[model samples]
Target: YSIFMCLLMSCISGIGRATALALARCGANVTAVTRTQTDLDSLVQECPSISPVCVDLADWDATDAALQNIGTIDLLVNNAARTSLQPFLEVTQDQFDQTFSVNVKSVLHVSQIVARGMKARGSGGSIVNVSSQASQCALRDHAVYCASKGAVDTLTKVMALELGPFQIRVNAVNPTVVMTEMGHLAWSDPEKSKKMTSRIPLGRFAEVEDVVNTILFLLSDKSNMINGITLPVDGGFLAC
Candidate 1:
């Protein structure tokens, strides 16, 4: 199957890179979309099988045009997002717009584009939106981030309801404090890390592979019946 994945930030690191490599290893032809040529080069170096497309998802028009070129894909993963950690009152208009544009609007636009192709092909397809645990629970300094993810959760349900007749499965994966480079730096403080991990029954942050595995499952036929749910890969943080 052909897989199309969008990773807004650096393509060489984080969930996007891991997902691309994993999918390629599974023998699926993977097309990775990102914003930087440098990161695209790095991703190609890491996995020569991945086809890289450079397009800024923040630009709706450009993203739409780029999606048209990708043709029809069997699977789509909207993993691109912009996060701003600031007090609700301190968030600037630009910051809010930027965050929503990348996190929410892009998902809507890209999914529409891809879903149309899926419908045209007369075959089923899977879409996975990378969400966050912040959507369901409150977190300090995550007002906008939480709000964006909340929108994603709602969108997933609506999309599933509308697209299920066409044999399209839509779902979201909500992960908490994944141990990416940025994740480790953000929670590097011993006190903060301990306090956060203490709340999770697993007592540890998630690794990229954890998120990748869940995504793979959701994309695969194993989750054929699952639709419109935001499955949490949060190390049981929400259980507390």
Candidate 2:
């Protein structure tokens, strides 16, 4: 039997790196789409199963051209996003545009490109979009970020509805503050972190594996019946 191959594109954050490594460990050939060649080189070193396609997802033409060459895709993850922390009234136009460009537009572009391949191949596939708990709940200084994730959740549902007949599953994974390097940097202050963690029934932020495991489940046949749902790996944060 041939090994399963999954094309996973992330913004090369800690979650993306961990997810890529885990997929490789499971014996899937991983093609990582990232903008930073430095992160790409380091990730490829960490896991030889990964191949690199360096393209800034914000560039529609470059991303389209790049993915056009990836051949076949059995699974896809749209994990690229950008955010600026500011009050709704303080948010600038550039901040809003940049956030939407990467957070919302890229998801549509990448998914469309990959889904076309899946549909044409007729082998079916799974798509997981990394969203956030902020999409469901209001957070201070997260107006733009929250709005973009909400778009992703809606996109997930619509994709699932439209693609189900083609046997392609689409879902979104919404996680609370994950303790990645970036996560830690953003939430390392004990006072700030506690405010958020206290609301979670789990009483702690998520680890990298928490999100990765969920993505793996969605990609595997174990979740064959699941589609269009935004599954939260946030330790019950959204429930509160």
Best TM-score among the predictions, by candidate number: 1
How far out, in Å, is residue 169 in model 2? 0.2
lDDT score, candidate 1: 0.92
lDDT of 1 by residue, 44-115 (tens): 998898999899998998987877878769999999998878987798888889999999999999899999
Off by over 4 Å in 1: none
Candidate 2: C-alpha lDDT: 0.84
TM-score of each: 0.98, 0.94
After TM-score superposition, the amount by which residue 121's alpha carbon in candidate 2 deviates from its true location, in angstroms, is: 1.1
lDDT by residue for model 2 over 1-240, one digit each (tens)?
Answer: 012222234335578888878888888878888888887887887776688888888889988888787877888888887778999899999999989989988888898988898899899999999999988999998999999999999999999999999999999999999888888898989999999899999999999999989998998899999989999998988877
User: What are the RMSDs of all candidates, in order?
Assistant: 0.9, 2.2
- Pairs in clash, predicted candidate 2: none
